[model samples]
Target: MRDTTADGAADTTADETADRAGLRGDCENCFGLCCVALPFARSADFAIDKPAGKACPNLGEDHRCGIHARLRQKGFTGCTVYDCFGAGQKVSQLTFGGRDRRTASREDARRMTDVFPVVRQLHELLWYLTEALTLPAARPIHGDLGRALETTEALTRLDPDDLAALDVPAHRQNVNVLLLKTSELARAGIGGRKKERRGADLMGARLKGADLRGANLRGAYLIAADLTGADLRGADLIGADLRDTDLTDADLTDALFLTQPQLNAARGSTGTRLPESVTRPVHWTPRL
Candidate 1:
């Protein structure tokens, strides 16, 4: 049997599982978009220089990376960690239906590039929503997550021209409302004084600046949720899905089992601080 279980992201670690589900880079089916569409500077993360919208210098004519297998040794770990969340396959097979970008008209190519970001953003949201539904605690937000997920999915199915015209940021602004609601439900699961948050579906809640010190937050669905400025000192964070969850400005000085990537992803406000072993994630606004 295939286990016949609901091992969606909320229940399982969407980090590892989603990566293995053929969601990561499989360039054979792609046009090397990440290599070209994304910009890279000469740094420890990237060995050679590459500009946005230009093909990578190492990109092979056959739409492959010259050093595909040795990307890590060549300092492309960021490239390796990136997951299109199924967008690469969708764009390759459906959006353009395996049409080669090389033959595309210059204007069409630019339009295609424009739409790639839109689809990419939508797929990322899919990954999060799919992961959220796996939580037994998040059942309360199931209706909201389902509706928003469908909306996001519909956007992903748009054709190149339609996708190019999409205002993804504005759509994100609207979806963030539901995501924020989902976050509140999920974070509420982190056992608090009220006790109603216990076993709550908090897969991706935004608990920024919330007080959760000494709270029982075990087995919470915390994958990728933002916890900026949240007080979590001595909070029971064991078994919580912390993958990619942002803790920026959050105080976790004595938090238990708050893993590296999870702790690293967090953005701490003035009130939010962490233990010495943990480091801040790459993304965050520390102006506060």
Candidate 2:
């Protein structure tokens, strides 16, 4: 629920306040955890290969990105797309008590680094759960979503050892079931039956200008696919691989479970319609 203002500042909107959301990254309150804890190989998205626990050269002592203004220009496009869902600050301030890995004891540092990714997964689930609760079509399962949200929230507060020991994949599978149900209910409200493409391997498929209203695209491999001008209103895109997907002029006004990361990895034009939850990536222009 954290959106960028016209000036690119993380501003809280009225909807965010109404939901009491904590899903936006608050870098000011974090210890630059992602810059150091996450690993990256030299790829189209990253400039260099960095192992886990190694700090990026552009990370400043103040825990701010030194190349924030030119990340894409400097071949660090992945950094711009990454969102910790407020996990960085929660792990920094609450779990580690503001102690950064740089200055902490070796054991604490290792644990902090390990616990970050675990907490991040929980926070991501919280983001989805919070969104699910907002859908009126999912009203029948609102109680379950609220309980899942509470459980995920509590998991994020666990000690580093407990968090690191968690079977996250198992938890994710359980949450996915509920999310799939939510998707069904939401799309059902869109009227006619939807295309059943859930878990389909549609990599590089040509789907330009297709009528995909109420489609089930969960876990679809849409990498490098042409989705230009597609009518994706009310489609379920959770876990969809959207890397390099062309979304130019596509209508995703009411797309379900679409995240900022997915949009960041895709190409879009000024004509692309998006939901209120996410901001269009800066590089998405007509020329792309």
Candidate 3:
């Protein structure tokens, strides 16, 4: 049976469920823009070097990954970590009116490809702005967040030329200021002296059972670190490299700015705690 709240919305909080709607990629609606427009070099993440605006050899006619299930085994782990935040589909359907670059004119195709990255950047800002709206500590600036969200959303609907002409980095800098304030408000709610490891090089460090409450770990390199049973409540993990970081029994119930890609890159167990806004990765297993 389905559930509903008093306001007739879903029972789950917006961040837990509805927040992802129209924000997460719907590949079915997408024209495989990421595979077609983005260049990827041959590395641990890909099996071949492909130039931008060229369709990947593995992309099917229907815009699906030919090796979707076997991507990792075929040296395409990077694809698994990517989430367009729904920009691909928006570009494919709304912006191009369901036009497939495969069948479109060369110039139109090129324009679509060019606009995609711009819309993607705007959509990412929209994602963070939407998340900021959900935080109670950020209520003071909810008006600002709402306005930013609306403006960013409007940008995604612009014509291809307008999108390509957008100064995305400048806009991102403006958005970052608000996001930093949101992070501060959210972390301050934790209320305690905490570690400051922002931008620290902690690759392969052993941090088992370490106390990191309210820690500022933005952009920290935590790759291959053993963080078993670590207390990371209220930590700011924006852009943190969590690749192979063992999260067994680690507490991240209030971690700020922790994105899905970061969580996906990390190794965790069923014993690991997480914020309600995030979910356990399918690759995670029970602690043995």
Give the Cα lDDT of each candidate.
0.63, 0.86, 0.84
Best by lDDT: 2
Lowest summed lDDT window (length 10), candidate 3: 1-10
Clashing pairs in 2: none
Query: Regarding lDDT, does 1 or 3 come out ahead?
Result: 3
Winner on lDDT between 2 and 3 is 2
Candidate 3 lDDT over residue span 64-175, tens digit each: 9999999889998888888788899999999899999978888989998798888888887877777777777877777677667777888899988889999999988899
Q: After superposition, how far is residue 234 of candidate 3 from its true place, in Å?
A: 1.5
Residues 5-94 of candidate 1: C-alpha lDDT, one tens digit per residue: 243222233343543354334566888777667778887667878777888888888888798678768887556445565567678777
The segments of candidate 1 whose C-alpha lies over 4 angstroms from its true place after superposition are 1-24, 192-288
Across 1-288, the per-residue lDDT of candidate 2 in tens digits comes to 333344433332327534534677889999899998999999999999999988898999999999999999999999988889889999999999988887789999989879999998888898788788777788777767776777788889898899989999999999988998999899987877689998899999999999999999988999999999999999999889998899999999989989888999988989899998888888898644
Q: Model 2: runs farther than 4 Å from truth?
A: 1-20, 286-288
Comparing 1 and 2 on lDDT, the stronger one: 2
* Cα displacement (Å) at residue 89, model 3: 0.8
Query: Scored by Cα lDDT, where does model 1 land?
Result: 0.63
